[model samples]
Target chain A: MLETAVFVIRRDLLLAMRRRSDVLTVLLFFVIVVSLFPLGVGPEPALLRTIAPGVIWVAALLASMLALSRVFAQDYADGTLEQMLLSASPLSVIVAGKVLAHWLMTGLPLVLLAPVLALQFDVPQNFLGELMLSLLLGTPALSLIGTIGAALTLGLRGGGALVALLVLPLYIPVLIIGAGALDAAAAGLGAGAHLLLLGAFLVMAAAFAPWVAAVALRIALE
Target chain B: MLEAIDLQCTRGERTLFSGLDFRLRGGELLRIAGANGSGKTSLLRLLCGLLAPAGGSVRWHGEDIRRLREEYWGRLVYIGHANAIKDDLTAAENLAIACALGGHRVAAGALRSALDQLGIGGSEHRPARVLSQGQRRRVALARLALSEHSPLWILDEPFTALDARAVDIVQEMIASHVARGAAVVYTTHVELEIAVAVALRIDLGAAAV
Candidate 1:
């Protein structure tokens, strides 16, 4: 099982590396969207600082969603998904590996880019760490939960839009807590509680999302 | 051994097949012959435990496959209508990933040889998207060359996009596999040239529920 998971991760990462443009598009989308917020809202430092956490978190959510739609679609189109379901390893194990790969491809980049984007918003140096930390914890949950939506909508017409509709509602708690942590930090309040809650969400999502996604994939294949 | 007892299948409001019964033991080959929309693919899926039969059960070695699950899948190699090839990846990369997912981590050298055997030699580095349909199908069929140890092979339309030469290559592979005491269950509209001793052909058009 472990070997299968590692193989899947390696395969997906290799595929992503070969198709460098897809990854770049998601990264550029995140950067562009975050940058546009400042231009649209004007250069009022206090205003940008106050809105930084929410704007960045929302952009991360959208960027991850864009990546999530392709998570299973390509595999489904090529019949790799059926082969995956038939593998010797349990379906949930493969699903978990794919979700982990998705996080690495999409979520991790946003977390890495958050600090740079946060700096553009003039977020305090001390609070920048909180923004990155909150994203680091929360984005995995987004990827995990978003995978369920991606699987549910696999192969459907207009699936990309439908996935966002199904998943954005589920993302509210993570977004609220992730952004709230940075806001609390900026207000001299301890961000620990929000960060801990985000971590808890990650744990919950990691435990159950793969199994749900597996079931959804089976339905989609049928 | 693989056996299906009174297998029934329904999609939406239509019943595809019912009371389907068959058995495949060592050194046997069962051909599921059917017209389009006659549930050939569904039966293959049911045998592999990908789709649940509305009635009855499928068993491997006398144990229900649903209970055996991974143990059963570990010994089975299934290739469906979709070649499962990634367009962005090379032929060699596609084979490596497919073999790995099927619990067989083939070495680069082995992958190249397998592709070569399937008549796709020296094109391992080209992305699958650039390959012709016949070449792509050969890449998918090359899994058979790497999967000699698996006990059962479930293939759906393995000859769809193949040229005459490729078709003969596939037939030779299947014949050799059955000659070696392994079992094969496949769906094909065209007649297979396999010469196994215990060949059974069921035409689904006449066996509909």
Candidate 2:
């Protein structure tokens, strides 16, 4: 079963590698969104610093969600999901592997890209590490939770906007604590409490979201 | 061997079929005959455990399929009407991927040889997306020859898009697999053109409740 999960993750990663443009667009969107922030809100260093963490986290959330639609949608469209269903592996494991792969392509890149975006916002050098950390821990939860919305809207015509509608409400807590963690660092207070809360959310999502997504997938496929 | 006992399947409020019993044993090929919307694909999906039956049971080796799903699935290979091959991958890559997904490993040379047997050697390197429909079907059929672990093969419309030569090759492969003690369940609108001595036919038209 674990082997099948690993195989799925490996297969998607290989597919992503071959279709490099898909992942590239997410990065470009990240850059464009971050660049737009400075242009839209004037280049005031202090103002950019004040809003840097929140802006980056929001962009990461939306970008990750954008990238995630293609995750199961492609497999579902191509009949791979049906084959996966027929395989010996449990559906939850398949969902977990897919969520993990979505994180690798979507969340990991967003985390790695956050620091550069943070710099553009003129965030203090002292707070860059904290910003990146918050994103790394928070983005997986975003991907994990985002999958539920993706699964729910799997075959819906206007799935993209519907995914945003379904996920943003569920994403509020993570967004609050994630930005709070970085804000605490900037304010010279301990960010540990917020980061711990973020980790807790990750644990909770990792435990339940895949099962929910699996059930949703079964419905969508049916 | 695979068998469905008094199986009843329904979708929504509509009962698709009822009291359908069929069996495919080692060294035997069974054909599922039905008209369009006669629940042929649904029946295949149910038999492979992709969908649940509203009533009755599916058994493999005398054990309920749901109870022994892993063992049953490990021994079965199903290729539906969709072809189920990733277009981005080459013909050889698609077969290797399928073999891997089925929990069996095939060496590169052996995989090439299998593709060669299906007369797909010349296009092995090209992406399957570019292959003609007949070639793609041949690529999927090639997996049956390469994987040893999947003893029972369930194919839906296995000859949907194939040339005369390709169809002949597929029939030969099915016959050989059955001769090697692997049970086969397949559906085809068109009749099997080749002369196989005997086959059990379950016409869904007559089996309808």
Q: DockQ scores for all the models shown? A: 0.84, 0.53
Writing each residue's lDDT as its tens digit, candidate 2 over B5-58 gives: 999888777777999887777877888898877788889988888788899999
The Cα error of candidate 2 at residue A55, in Å, is: 0.9
| TM-score for each of the candidates | 0.97, 0.94
Question: Which portions of model 1 show Cα errors greater than 4 Å?
Answer: B206-209
Residue pairs in candidate 2 whose N, alpha carbon or C atoms collide under 3 angstroms: none
Worst 10 residues of 1 chain A by lDDT: A123-132
Candidate 2 chain A: 10-residue stretch with minimal lDDT? A80-89
- Where does model 2 exceed 4 Å of error? B193-198, B206-209
Candidate 1 DockQ, CA atoms: 0.84
lDDT of 1: 0.92
